[model samples]
Target: MTTLLPSLPPQSTLLTQASQVLMHNYSPAPLVLTHGNACTVWDAAGNAYLDFTAGIAVNTLGHAHPAIIEAINTQAQQLMHVSNLYATQPCIELATQLTQLGRFSKALFCNSGAEANEAAIKLARKWAKQHKHPHATQILVFGNAFHGRTLGALSLTPKEAYQVPFAPLMPSVKVGVFNQTENLDTLITNHTAMVMVEPIQGEGGVNVATPEFLQALRRRCDETKTVLWFDEIQCGMGRTGTLFAFEQVEGVLPDGVSLAKGLGGGFPIGAILVNEKLADTFQPGDHGTTFGGNPLACAVGLAVLNELTQPAFMATVRDCGSLLHEGLGQLQVDFPQLVVDVRGWGLMQGLALAEDQLAVGDLVTHARNAGLLLVGAGGNTVRLIPPLVVTPTEIHHALGLLRSILGGV
Candidate 1:
């Protein structure tokens, strides 16, 4: 005989129950979000919040967009998953569009940013061994970089706190200073198989790479014949007022680009786009994923790409970004003691706090209490990454809330 299950408890008790059963990996806020629409989300207690985090920059078109919803519903009714053994129309079409948009010759799908970086790592190593010397296997990364938590990706992310527990990570990884073009020659050696850098370091306090720095890296990589890769997981896919962040930087392009986060607009999907030079790096059995290119995920990805590629949509992003930047600048001027600096491009902006006066977490809590959600990055910086569809009115309201919070503090 089968045992009957217990009834669900009230919404208020959900967090308590979660604490008992779930692992303590994430310390989420107290609010239990029920649903969302556009840039607004409502909790179980019926309180509405203007979401500036946008699910950590994963919700490209905002929550419950009609196109995303429709694509998911239609694709679910028809096809969802089929192993990579057979090809699917949505997968093929999405790949084709991505290749054309990213100006890459090939694409490899995966489940998350970590997986995409892992694939790029493997491809870089393999290509180096085949085309270059077999001993050229070093992977060069930068300081204050946050790639992902997976072993291979984690190895490249030079954080003492994240790496202390997981000792003995993947070997042959070197750390370099970000945006310091002076010492690039010393960092990237002939044995270096690949050099991975985030054009804009997200978790590292929105540290944007200078165009001169990127150009220097490209030149050095060419001199050493090393694969140049970019981790655009958080800053790519129209977040920076362009399809790719590299578009803003002239005379620089990566041999491979790893993408995820907003690619599927909330649906989980990751991909690596490689130029023709490294197009055939991965053989048939070299890399594969069970649910990477499933019909449902690819369908959602296509819908997101469709909306982001619209000329009007991208123009709106640029206009609103300028407005948001101006608002943040005003905040800095108003609260000179609290707000130290403001930085970032497009909709991905950050306000660096005066840590001596206010901590990032305290400011985040204040914003949440005032019905606005924000995310914190390194260097005491609070990120304001609202959806690409956020309006000027919502931005004004968010700024108003922030002004009130700072005034009250």
Candidate 2:
């Protein structure tokens, strides 16, 4: 264990002040985080914790990377905000770069994953009405898939726990079994407009879609002339040790892709990549956003893409990810009773507990107290999403902390 840091001022006053103003939608930890460096962040009380969550996979290059900070600073000085009515050079440049990488002809920018996905949904719906069967309005999504929080996205997310509060969402959403090839055939009827899936379901417990299953879905979508969409919001942008998570599964490509989370490396930015098939789906005034393609966000996104997609950087990620995986595998062997499975691709891995009685939340709480931070996913899974910039040494350190926690338990 590391040396205990000095205690700072109480955060009760801070929480009390925030409760008066901020909405009660989120249940944030009591600690007031002040600043972060690399994969470690210090709370207001001067205690540092190894950040495995990586802002839920938003900080691709880790917190406050010099490149991201410099890009934000430079763009802020030049031009910060501009309406979408006026074209910005930074946005155009970023779009061109993203198109080049994603094999898409066009791109649309947005502020968050939800907006990006919403754009995809709208584009798919438009295509269905105009191109496919007019009655084809059904959006097919998989069970345990989390697209986003918007009503359209929520309609596809079939989790009753999240959906009950906001009942009566978008119509004709067909929910199927994720990674189960047999179940998808029934769901993809003639009325199916779009089939949206995550290459790897991040919030749904790091469940990776089998390559065969994806290929089958691809074939079906092609046969039905339905738009295939991949929600790479959490699993894309080098999280899966590749440019896109779908790249890992060969012979399977989505007509549309929703990207966000790690795209801007901490800066809020999202985008949809559309292939030639759906490139012309959205005409002017079809769909838009006020702060979608702002210069500052695009500048940061460009910087993040440049750093993350480099040959050396990606090679390093592969090596570090291997190390982390090996360590986790060893941990699974060491504590088989506790760990049910360690499954995921690249840095987006998870440790699913053996039973509900284990309580993944309690493990996360204990890990946080031990100076290592983690987040829980569905299926009683503990997610380990350290920044892609994580080194081999850092990986070992994290494993040590995790082993210590497990040993104590």
Candidate 3:
């Protein structure tokens, strides 16, 4: 993975030029990343850091993997963008793979998790309007659930910081406690068009949904004819040791599910898998995207899927994921003054910090300076999501780095 782009200026000069031109949407770290391999990345200053953030869980296969690079190069040489009006082989093949895996009949492609969740929202609402009770237009979402920042997805995301600037969101949204079974029975009703939930709340402190609560939601959705949707943007695509995180829990299924983050291995592709019930509910003109199912994205998506769905690769994820989870759990016990709790499945984990310790932002900055990248989730959570291809050695190295940062090891 040699440098493909032209090298010119130092980190400070490059960052200064970027600041002059680029928008201030994101507050990035002081260092500028140049290239990466496996779970390690190099800054412009030539310092290498072990990456546990994995670009916020978007880089499924890690940076500059041979397969993903080949897919990108091959697709660039052949075809790139095609409007949704026409069909492409890559699109067809990728959709087939995803639908077959989810046991769904159809898929709607988009460019991000927000768009995928938005598609799910529209499909559920339209289905409710056409078939279910005409008055059934309410939507149920859990607290601390992060779908995306898009208007429709943001409306359901109940975080104050993210939703404060954008007020007057969609109406009829009833909030339910995630993993709380008692509140779900009464919170969801026939008036609910959709009940959107995350298998594990990634940005919301890595809180996992209880199997009992999921089963209860499934039963209630069945009884009320409401479409059950899962926002697997951050937790899906083999991150949870399954094709879909919901698969790990028996007797629970979704009418539709949205996917995005790792689908194309950081190539920016999204999709919604709708079961047979709402498969035919969407008409041709109901929803569409111009650049959603383009050939380049689909080709990369197919390549990533080909790599991820392999039996051997999945086994590695399970083994490596368990090791990572256990290491983090041990960290919690080792630093009770700093760590409040540790929770998650597979590699998508979180460590909630004690109020007495440093803020998550400061801790993340300290960890970054120590040559280990970590991201802060909502609340006092420090998120750790390494690439699926991360090795046992890399996991141990990351844990050691974290321990060193916390004044141990």
Provide TM-scores for the models: 0.97, 0.97, 0.97
lDDT of 2 by residue, 220-325 (tens): 9998889999999999999888889888888887998999999989999999999998999899889999999999999999999999878788778777878888
Candidate 1 or 2, higher lDDT?
Answer: 1
The candidate with the higher lDDT, 1 or 3, is 1
Question: Lowest-scoring 10 consecutive residues by lDDT in candidate 3?
Answer: 1-10
Tens digits of per-residue lDDT for model 1, 131-156 = 98889899999999999999999999
| Lowest lDDT block of 10, candidate 2 | 1-10
Model 1 steric clash pairs: none
Best by lDDT: 1
Clash count list over all predictions: 0, 0, 0
lDDT for model 2 comes to: 0.89
Clash number for model 3?
A: 0
